[model samples]
Target: MTTFDDREKAFENMFAHDQEMQFRIQARRNRLLGEWAAAKMGLTPEETDAYAKAVVQADFEEAGDEDVIRKLMGDMTQAGIDIDEAGVRAALDEQQVIARRMFIEAQ
Candidate 1:
């Protein structure tokens, strides 16, 4: 391949890698967020694990974090926990940071 073609391929590969990493980071964040919400709801250890998985699955329902947030909020409400969107958003941001840090450390 010509140098230009080689460079283009490298950039495409880099973009793909970045997208995969972002997906992983978001998934980790979702799991962490699920764990946090589970604790707030006083879920049992076994239930917590399942709930965390459910939260991660919720993300597949839509394109962005809203689906996961909605699931958490609805579940929390049913559990008689008082929390708002802002609280959930804050937790999401916090967990994302933790997720990114964990990924970096792993590398």
Candidate 2:
């Protein structure tokens, strides 16, 4: 391959790797946020695990974090936890940091 082809392939590989890392980070953050909310809502250990998985799946509903936020807000409200979207957003922000740390440690 030409030098240009090699450069292009390298860039593509890097982009793919970055995309995967971002996905992992987001998924980790979602799980962490779910666990936090579950505790707040008094979910049992078994329920917490299922709720965390559901939160991760909720990310697939949209392009950004809106889907996950919406799900959390809805679930919290249904449980009579009296939480707002902004509160959930804050939890998401905190979880993002935890997720990054966990990912780096794993690496």
* Estimated TM-score for each candidate: 0.97, 0.97
Instruction: Give lDDT tens digits, candidate 2, residues 1-107.
Output: 69999999999999999999999999999999999999999999999999999999999998999999999999999999998888999999999999999999999
Pairs of colliding residues, candidate 1: none
Estimate, for each residue in 1-107, the C-alpha lDDT of model 1 and write its tens digit: 69999999999999999999999999999999999999999999999999999999999998998999999999999999999999999999999999999999999
lDDT of 2 at 64: 98
- RMSD of candidates 1 onward, in order: 0.8, 0.9
State the local distance difference test value for candidate 1: 0.96
Query: TM-score of predicted model 2?
Result: 0.97
Instruction: State model 2's lDDT.
Output: 0.96
